[model samples]
Structures are given as structure tokens and as C-alpha cells.
Target: MFKNKKFECYLLKNRIPGVVLAVLMTVFMLMMAGRFELFNRLDSKTYRTLNEIESISNPYGSDVKITVDRADYLGYDYFVDSERQGSYYICQQDGRYAILLLKSNDDVVLNYTIKGRMISGGSEYSSIIDGITSDMGIAVAQLETRMYPLIISEVDFPRIYYNMMLLVLIVTVLWSVYVIVRCIYEVSCPWKVRSVRDVLGKRADRQTIRDIDSQLRYEMYYDQYGIAITDKYFVCHGMWHTDVVALDNIETFKKLRTSSNIGSGKKKIYKLLMVDVDGVTYEQDFRSEKDINEALSYLSDDKRVKR
Candidate 1:
């Protein structure tokens, strides 16, 4: 049902990579959402007292929820290069005292420590718990002999899952939207007909329209890179741009060769330099000597060519 079969095929070929990437990212985002939901339902709600949490060997990596009835603020606070990451508190319940590491000073003293009991939410044992307690003179000795320490923070496993899912969801949604927009544009205006119309303007006659359409078809069928050479105009297509220069406006055309260092090797680059009557120079790179020579052959009859 498409008018230009070659242009339609080119659009489909170019869009495949983006479409595949959007699909894969969407699938991965869904998988992470499912995992996050499962973890939130199974792990985050189980709460234990300080004694039970301290009894577990290697509690460092495990996610634990604890209930605290009363806490005495230890004057000591933990900082990493002037930024406070945790605050120290002494929790005493049922004749048991354990050092608690909280995210903020307000979290330790607000409402619960001043008034009644509080359920400290899900927390992972801090890797730096030893460093935090080692410098507190008397409290260090008390923690070593009478009680163990627990590190609690606002960040937990379920939050981590939710954050990751949110990030992937944003990226997948943006990319999918971009791909859909591009597909719509390609279907509506194949062969960049809108660009050609803009270049020719409203008063363009039938012959000019036919010439531009013929040149575009020739470029799609035979042009190796994105360069199109016709008797009336020269067209260059780029990732984000399309340059159309009338043949009559050309001033100078020359071949250029240069050497470039690529990684550990040296490579030769070939290009065509065309300067318009207004002194605007357009340089386009070609893949090889043969390709550049073929493009040059199209301009053999033009008097602007510099040997």
C-alpha cells in the first residue's frame, strides 16, 4: 500500500534497531517491577526486637525491621567528610541495651523516644558500624561487653527495588515514545517529501517537482552514502540535516585526501569540497577512493571542477 517501496524499506530498516531496543527495555522494566512487588510483600513487614536481631550471625547484609520502645541519644554522631550519614542512639528495652544507628537526629528523638514506642522500619546492617562505635569512649566498652549494635537507615531493600524500577520505567517510556513518533513521521512523509517541498517553495512548477522526485529516487537506488548528484542539484543527507544545493550556484569543487590516527593505526580519509557562489563550503566524506571517484565523475562536464 506504500507509494515508494524503496523509501518504505529504507525507513523500516533504519527503525528496526530502535524498535528492538525499546521492546527489550520495556520487558526488563516489567521484570524488575514484578521482583520489587514480590520482595515488598515477602520481606519488609516482618519485625523483630533488638535482642532477636542481634542474635543473628552476620546480620550485616540482611534486611531487618526492629521495634524500639525507648532510646537515649548518644552524644556521638557519624559523619563521612562533614556529611552526616547516621546518628547513634542507645535503645533500652526489657533490660537489654543495643546501639542503634539512625539516619537522622530527628528520627531518633521525634515522637517515639520522647513519648511512646515506635516501630523502626526495614533496615540493613551498616558495613561501617564498627568504625562508628570504636571512637565513643565509654559507650564502645559497654557495647562490646553488654550489647551489640544495629545500623538502621531510611534506605532499605524494597526502596532500592522501587527506585530501580522507576528509573527503568522512565527511560523505557521516553524511548518508546520517541520510536513511535519517528515511525509516524516516516509513514506520513517518505523520502523526506516535506523537506523537498520546503526547499522548492509554494510557486514551484511541475517540472521542478518531477526533477526533485526523480533525483530522490536515484539517490535511494544508487547512492552509497547519503550524497545525491543530479543535473540540477546536489543533495547531502545527514543524521539531523539535509542540505540541498543548486548546481548553478556552485563555485568550486575539489577532492581532498587526509591521514588520521585511528586507535593504534593510521587511516586515509577522502572527501569532496564544494564551495558555493556565496563562499559557503560544503565538505562530505566518502568511504573509499572508488566512491569519491564515482561521485566526481558525475561533475565531469561542470566547469567549476578544479583538477
Candidate 2:
């Protein structure tokens, strides 16, 4: 099967474009998955606490005094600004802001700003049902390209969304690999038949043959070579050489039937002839039903044929 047929012709005919498309798609999916994963992790519990802190504190005056026994921000230690001057304490090493969480009037108050839309800007009511549907919709959008501009509105900054994205990323990678391998397989397969002129320096006269139904044909297009029969030997001639099989050494013949273009109007039937001659196995495709029957008649006198 031509899993990569669409691009096979393109790839076989033009290598540059094929390789370029392959590389681009691979890179795009990887970057898309990576970026989405980063945003997804930003919605973790630590960042959730940060978002909550920002939501409560941004509305209050910057001069409001706040105190905290202990607070955690990205696993960093810090205190609320005592001077009512600096809104947050910046860690010297990582530069991550540790927002203050304080208990006031029996309600927790968060006093700092949380940066980035992925962390700060979604509604409070979270539902797994909505999240799944959102993931599917975004995954569909990402099938063609990972460009943020094209899918910005449909995108959701959730772990599930990135999980779906990772699935898409895996599928894209596998499909690309399949396409490349299939294309190589198809291209490397031998051509059906070679021209006589290429194998032989001179052009030979066309031969005539009779079918099993006694129909006469002036010209026959044998794939490899024309056939000639004699009382003592069955001769098959190719462009380069002739193959001679003695009648006494002939063995059983097999006819394998195969079909193509299934379920289509232009479907075709074909038969492969496998012959055993003097312990050597030879196989060839029969051009037509009549040709197959005629070829088998020479090899065996029996009316019955193996299917």
C-alpha cells in the first residue's frame, strides 16, 4: 500500500521538496508539544496559589501592610514587603517572585502579581467535561500546523490540552516515518518490465501466437520476452538471453489469482504463473486469461489446473 503515495510521486520525482516538508512537519509538532507542555505545568498547584494571591491583592492599594508566618512561591522562601514599597521580593538566584499569603479577618489574602496569561487569566469554575471537549477541538486545529496565531482562540492552557497535544505530536511523528519508509519501498521496487532495446542492441520481429480459445493475435506484448514451443523443449526468450526447459523435466504448474482496484468500477483480475522446471522455480504474471491457459497447456497435458 502507498501510505505515502500522495507524496511518493512528489518525493520520488523531487527530493528537495519532500525532505523539506518532512523536516518542517517534524519540527513543528515537537515545538508545539513542548510549548504546550510548558504552559500546562504553569497551572500546577504552586502557580494556582500564585494566581489566587494576585487575584486578591491586585485590587488593594500597594501601601497596604501585610504579614505572613510562612508562604511558598515556586518552593522559594520570602516575606511580604514591610516598607509597603516593593510589591514582591525577588529571589537573587532564580529571580522568581514569592508572593505573600496572609490571614486577615479569617480570610486568606494574596498580595502580589502573577505574570503570564497561562497562569493568571482563566475563570474559577473548572470542569473536566469542558476540558476534554476543549482538548479535542484544539487537537483538531493543531493537526495541520502548530502556529499559535492560527489556533490562538481555540487553544486552552490546561494540562489535558497539552496531553492531547502530545498524542497528536506522537501520531504526526509516526505517520511521517511511515510515509518515508513506504515511499522508499515503492520507489525501490523493480519496474514491471524493461524495454527490449535497452537489453538487446537490435530490435527483433514481433511474434504471433494463438490463445487457448484459438483466437489469433498478430502482436503480443510479453512483459519480459516472447515464448516459443517445440516438441522437445519450451523456450522463453528475454531481451538478453533465452531460457530452455526440457519437456521431460517439467513439473506441476500453479496459477495464483489476485485482484486490484477492489470496489472500483475499473477493477482488474490478474494471474501469476509459478512453474517448477528442473528443480528451478520460475514465476511470471499472465497477461490475460487466454494467455495463462495457453501457457499452462504447454507445461501440462492434464485439463485440471491448480488454483
Candidate 3:
């Protein structure tokens, strides 16, 4: 089976896309699995103190509790939208200064536990704090040196991130399974001579089978799809079906050119359109104009193929 050029070509053409997709999905699955394991191992329940924020390693995903006994609102609030907002504050806990971001809501409290993930502050937040400190006539250097200022949100960011990754991983697994199954079906169960003859309503005879087997040896064009021209028949090997038409039954054959915009330029697509005497049309795509032209040249000698 591997030595036959037609079967080998068909196998590779149908299997390569699925194999590539499965490999990519497998890589993504491994990466997501590692991330999920990391998140599962993190300490999400125990709340760390503000003083330990800088000292603790991998504080980005760890839960932290900020006791806001003395908070100076900087009069600046960050708004993602109308529904979501965070107010910045400069808090003092046991002479240690740290930045706190409280989710905007009714019934403000001066003393409460602000619990959430300890996320590093971005440069934009630093710039905003710089302006706030300047307006209040306070030096930024006055803040504690042991613990740098960081943002603390009320939202459970770690849980949300883990859920999003899980959703993507599930989708990738499903797609990988579908591609693998399709590739297996295409390669394992190809269209045999009997199958092609049945599709074309040919009689069950040794001569008919022999003719198809002989024609398959010399494919005019073979890729994901194929077309074979013999002395008396035109055999088309489609992705999911095989069709054989007698040369006398073919009424018309024409080349079609279409152009479509791709980015900043146009890409041309070439196809061969075949119409039988019964007005049944079959269209096959060609990778290039030269390939379509070559296929057309093979049928130019036949009087039945009207071009």
C-alpha cells in the first residue's frame, strides 16, 4: 500500500493537516495542565500581612489581607467601566505604608479587611501616585522602604484566571479528537474500485474494475483531491467520494478564474468546471493556473470535452 504512488499521495494529503492540528493542541494542553497544577498548589486561603507582601516569594497569586485602619484617599479612582471601579488609598499599618485599591461600593468603612490577590502595580499606577503625592505636598520617599506599594482588588482573580484556562483547554481537546478521527477515517478507508463503480452506477464486471484500476495508476492531478484521465473515462477522487464519468457523457469543460482581496492585495483562484450531458456540474479547485492548464491540455484531444 505504501509503494503505490496514488495511495501514498492521498494518505499524506489527508493526514498532514490533522496531524499538525493534533500536535499543536497537545502542546497547548501540556502548557495549560502545568498552569493548572501550579494554581492548585498555591495558598489561596491563608491571608498574609502587609509587611510580608514584599518578603514572600510568588506573591502575585497569593491571598493578602490589608487592614485599612488609617487610609488617606488620593481622590483618584480607576474605572474599567461604569460597573467596575477601584479607589486608591495610601494606608499605614504599624508604621508600614502600602497602597490599597478598594472596589467602589456603597457604605464606606474606615476599618475593614481588604482581601484579594497581591498584584504588582504597573508604571501607570506609579505615575498616578506621583501626581497625588505632589498635590498633597507629601514626598514619595516618605513611604516605607521595606514593602513597596501594590494594588489589592476584592475580585477573586486567581479563580477567574484558572476557569478561563480550563475552558480553552477543553475546547482544544475536542478539536484535537475530531481532527484525529477524520484523518484516520480518510487514510484507512479509501475509495476502492468497487466503490467508485457503485457511485457511477457501473455494472459489476471484471473489465470495468480493471479499467478503473488501470486509470488510477496515471493520475492527471493529485493533491487533497485528484482527477485521472484515461482512454474512455474521467475519474474524480474527491475528499469524501469518488466519481467516474464516461468520456462520451461529458458535455462541457471550462476553466474559471476568480480574484479575492487578501490583506492589501488580490489572490487569484483557478478551478475547472465540468458539466455532464445530464447537466450535472462538478467543480475542482487547482492550486495554480499552470496546474489547471496542464490538466486541460490532457483532455484537449478528446472531442467530447468542449472547452
Winning model by lDDT? 3
Cα lDDT of candidate 3 equals 0.63
Superposed by TM-score, candidate 2 places the C-alpha of residue 204 at a distance from the truth, in angstroms, of 29
lDDT of each: 0.60, 0.38, 0.63
Expressed as tens digits, the lDDT of each residue in 1-307 for candidate 3 is 5444454354546567667868798787868678667444333444445666667676675666556665666666666767546676666666666666776443345776776666777874677667866876877665325335566655544656666767777778877887777666644444433444454554534455445555567633332337677666666665544556666566788889998898889989998887778887767778798888877877674654554
Error (Å) of candidate 2 at residue 112 is 10
Worst 10 residues of 2 by lDDT: 146-155
Model 2: per-residue Cα lDDT at residue 104 = 20
- Give per-model CA RMSD: 8.3, 18.1, 9.0
Local error of candidate 2 at 302, Å? 11
Clashes of each: 0, 0, 0
User: Model 1: which residue pairs collide?
Assistant: none
Higher-ranked by TM-score: 1 or 2:
1
Name the 10 consecutive residues with the lowest summed lDDT in model 1.
Answer: 113-122
User: Which regions of candidate 2 fall more than 4 Å away from where they truly are?
Assistant: 1-156, 185-221, 224-251, 254-288, 294-307
Given candidate 1, what's the lDDT at residue 106? 60
Tens-digit per-residue lDDT, 38-138, candidate 2: 44443432333322434543433211222223323222121236422112111111222232322122222244232222222122112221342375675
